[model samples]
Target: MPVPVGVIEQRDDGPLRRGPRAPAWRRGAAALCAGALPALAFPAPSWWWCAYVALVPWLLLAGSAPTRGRAALDGWLGGAGYMVAVHHWLFGSVHVFIVVLGGLLGLLWAPWGVLVRSLLGGADGPPGAGRSAAALAVVPSAWLLVEIVRSWQGLGGPWGVLGASQWQVVPALRLASVGGVWLVSLAVVAVNVAVALVIVSAASRLTATVALVLGAVATGSVWAWAPLPAESGAAPRIAVVQPGIVSRAPGSPQLRFARSEELTRQVADGRADLVVWGESSVTHSLATHPSLGRRLTALSRTLGADVLVNIDAPDTDARGRHGIFKRSTLVGPGGPTGVTYDKMRLVPLGEYVPARRLLGWVTSVGRAAGQDRVAGRRQVVMTVPRRDGGSLRVGPLICFESAFPDMSRNLANDGAQVLVVQSSTATFQDTWAPAQHASLGALRAAETGRPVVHATLTGVSAVFGPHGERVGRELPTARSASAVYEVPLAQGATLYDRFGDWAVYVAVAVVAAFCAWRGLRRTPGARGGLLRRPLSAPPVPPAHTVHGSPARPGR
Candidate 1:
């Protein structure tokens, strides 16, 4: 029936507002698939190109969500998939609790999903180039924020960031220098958004395509044109000792030390300026094992080089408290310089349980310690007096710390010409963990413009230049005891080391603009996109009818 003249009619568009919402099961399935996509971009699988489109599945789901609440759920589910897939090996360490951990950390991306859908208009907002551009900028910034938050050691530390997915991509590593991994992360997310728009934005495909092209060109130009730092004065011949082993279960520090010392003997001729051992190379404490300490001293004197060994042992304070510490100590021909760098950022289940009383019940594949490895106060660079001449500074990052970009950057900024990662990936050798662990050194080298000596126990020992270029062939997961490589120093600093994460500034600006735009468009009972609540929130009742009369309650 037709409405009478002067009477108004409401237009109902489609089932989206109230139709049987996408089934809970389908939504969940999509989320899991989308979330796990990024994992293929990481190690073991090592499909680096996959990262370019990994988030597309999740982004598409979120951009079309019926309500802000549903979008958040989708995002959360996807985030959960991502967490579980990337850190699935944690099951070996934390056992069944990995599920709970993924769920908890997945909360980090719930708000992000909602934001993406809101910018895509979710079920109600109009789609246009303006909105698309805004989404592209804000979504990536939001991702960075999420990464930064979840990166806290309490959560899991910053293990598998989206940018680190590009650890082997030279250009991406170049991007790391200026913005750190966060910057590369930002770029990756932005590219994903642009790619999404090509399929979704019908009216503005040309604009989306142009934006995509420009983004690609700009990233390429920055990488291709960037200048490589000059080679500095000295090229030191350094020997890295990796006492390869199959398992560390029955492995005592003494046994590991003996194996390392033997390997050092093979490589540490007068030709070597320094001999560096992998983490826990010296299982005994110098204070407790004076004999072993004397042996190291004698070895250094005989080789005419400085010895840097990692001591994983107990240090009892005057308070009579016992604590285990993993430290990198420098001992010379004369004696110990007393300069040591302790492992600051430790692995959650591997090194220490976060909450021992509550969660300690969940044990790792490796035995959980009664006490965690104590954290170091700060970053230290050990200066070794070159046997031939002037002194060369070496910065230390313990096993897990190499996975964090900021730690390496800190050491480089502090005048470390050579960055050494003393690591033990024996736990996950059969898995892709060893290769993935070894690859992280490339980004560190590129970001800091310093040579990285990635010495390890078990396998995958490698070296890289200031630009992340390989200095020599890497030893894979095997029993290769030692390798010697001459690393040339790169002079000066990359814009990244000098400037810090400039990408964060871009993220901050985008976020601020998004917030401001949301605030200005506020309507009665209608909050802007950023603050939109889920379908669970009570819908606002109409204040007045089109006829200008107050509408009835519950109408």
Candidate 2:
């Protein structure tokens, strides 16, 4: 007979075998899980496999650890692996900063390991149905908390969040309507837990498997049953211009400008109501350069569509401090609207470094030239008149600004019929950044119940309908391409749009309560009136202390 590695040794009198080796299948299972986790981060337009399998290794390792501490360590290792693999793209944008950022972000998973170990009872306890169900709730809840904490402004990069891995999974996406992205994240985690349980134990495997299937069915049913709002009959045909400038390297500015002009000219003759350019399409300010403005005016007239252009311009506020603004300018039809929306939510270091005065001397730490950029005061929804004489209100979000849910919601709530995100991902080209950035538009669409048209300078520029469905086609990143998409004016609003993050608040409270309950239960003397005072309280010190020691220390 084969010896079991993990099984405890038994004496001649005991019912169980002694010093047996752990089952070979269990160790093989764990190894398989560890190897499969890295790939979970990127799934082509279909990532449901990640939702079903990502947690298996953690589950298997948790089962192998004989003590709570060991289980915690195993979980932490899995978490670190998952985070580092998924966020590998961060290195491309901030290569030097990656080590510092990755380490700080990796800490977010440390507690997750501890929590999972405690919830599952050191992996050695009876793997009963009740325990399995509890695992489902606890694991997902832990993940949701980590995501919420990391998504905050300063803690970590929220890019490639686990929920985003399910971008193509329509059923999982329905959860976004209830609690933004966190709910979807929760559902994915829950499914993973259920799947892990079914794989580990045979006695209750059927039950666990059935439960997992039911959960998925429930998700799909929600998506199918959820009432989709009516879309307005008016459809605006918009052309997105991607003037692919592979390198934003210094000295290539003129080349980039020329390329932008060429692509704009190519699409100027299309049936576009409005020609939209990606962020930084115009490197110079149109207001300051009448020559550029005239050129844009001429393009609008020739194309017979209003040209919406984004320019990185210098603006001086009341204090006479010049700051760079990723400004969006509307030119065409009615002539120079002079209306511009400055980009908010700037990328740290990429756009402007934080604490620049102290860090500016570091050579790589200075703000992008033309002074530090100031964020826009509000979301700007510009009304662009269609060639058919009808006007379509477009909410303009610039580059990194599109990642924020509330920012997009504010625009839609303020009567933006279509959300337009003009972005330039040239700096972080060929990485997951473009694909990850593109995924945000779908969530934004789900949140506001509106279609979002994202036009990027490089690639992954695409359009999404009200229900977060992809429309027309997506352009590849880092290439010169133009796509015309007929986007519908969606009517009605999502529950999340109306209620905002209230559900998140409720979830936080619930998790907090559970943590508090667990903490209290773990305290000595809290259960069965077992008031076990420390064998004897430490001897009280004398009334007065003398110099380094108490007067009656020995007494």
Candidate 3:
């Protein structure tokens, strides 16, 4: 008969056996799947509730890993899975390089994985209540640190922030008004940690349950107690024109421009205070193309309102250097109003290759930009004449700029009454990218207490109220149309806008305090504080029973 692992067999010579370990491949695949699960919480599937538990599988795997090295590997694989899943749509444009980028970015999570294992299990079997409680704060703080590091514009920006998954949840939006998406992400990760402790550590079950209850209470408190934005009493009808997909043949710019003009004329109804076009609506710079300027001026005169158009064209600076700029220009009855905001943040590889001299070869791969686009020096808030004889301050964000929360908050701080994001996802019309891009406006609006207008060239143009509520029907990709949204203006700032990433600061402090407490635990005299271990000595191993026993000296 075969002897089972971990069981003692009686024979001429007795020995104990241990079970064979599971293969590394199986654990890695599980980690990858667990990491990808959170992407479902974003757009398309938009399973917001799934985000609350999406990290559990990964956390459990990391926590139970036999060694710290294996746990780190788990974190890397999981982070890669998450990056690929959330950005899978880019595969259409970025091709096979998306996988490589995902792997590189996944490195940011490796330390996080090791941290999880250390706090939850380490060499000991399961964590006690003290460690379980620390995990609630430290784990989320570590996650936030990763988020903040990866949120740099060069690092693909903050496209899939975990808290953004709750854009549709009113209570979550209320929390966003309090602390921006960072706080929401912190709360979400905390809940996941608490739940994992509840499932794995019976001794820490009460502690985990208390954390969960506190998260719920805090969210509820924000919803009930946060101050509301006062209405500015200047609701303006903003018209967004989507040209849909046009031919990519020669002269495509003119084709898109003509189509946008036709749609604007059809939808304006002379009631819109301002007519807005999507990113790259004008292909030719007005300085170089007098006729294009004449046409836009005529359109503005016919609509009886100023027009906001995005220009994607090359321009020559005073220094005689020429570069392509994605600029938002305002046109009144006159040709050009000189109120312009050039796009400051460029898409990493899509708009410009970072460290171009070293990485310029990427342009030969997939669809990376051949020449880097010039960045604007400063953000501009334009004052346009509202049809009611008062001026409205408009802040314009081009394409990827809208993904940044700080930019919108800065605009609100600069006295922008309405926020407009002019974007073109024509290359990704068939994918979920358009919908995902549009969803960001709601989060931005909720964070800054300002109405946001997301105008897209191909599809998925949307408007959100000051509180992140949808203002009108979305213009999806299938239709070539225009829609006017009555966007409400608001006064006063959201706590997130006022305090600016206070949640991140608090998280940093928590992590620092925890680290200090941990460092102090090693000292002989410093172990009697709040997180005192009930029983410090390691558990004694089970006594070995020897049948008949005179052993050899070597044995």
lDDT of 2 by residue, 1-555 (tens): 343665544321112334555774565445334634744555333455755676766766665555545555555555555665665666655555555555556567667766665555442344677667666766777777777777764444366567766666566556776567777777777777676776666754765787778886877777776655578877899998887864557867667666766777787557789888888887776657778888778778888888888888776533455778788889985466777787767766666656778755433532233246776666688998887888899999888777677787788789898999999877667666788788888887887788899998777799998878999878977468777888987787777778887646766776687788665645365344322222333455447655666466566
Q: How do all models score by TM-score?
A: 0.89, 0.82, 0.91
How do the residues 238-343 of candidate 1 rate in per-residue lDDT, one tens digit apiece? 8888777734567655577777778888875537888988777777788987998899998898888988888888875333546888988999988887888778
Q: Would you list the rank order by TM-score, best first? A: 3, 1, 2
RMSD of each: 6.0, 8.5, 5.9
Give every collision pair in model 3. 6-17
- 4-89 per-residue lDDT for model 3 (tens digits): 56764432111223557679899999999999999999888889999999999999999887666878999999999999999999
Cα lDDT for residue 381, model 2?
89
Candidate 2 RMSD to the real structure: 8.5
TM-score of candidate 3 on Cα atoms, chains taken together: 0.91
Which ten residues in a row are the worst by lDDT in model 2? 9-18
**Angstrom error at residue 150, model 2:** 0.9
Ranking by lDDT: 3, 1, 2
Question: What C-alpha lDDT, on a 0 to 100 scale, does residue 399 get in candidate 3?
Answer: 85
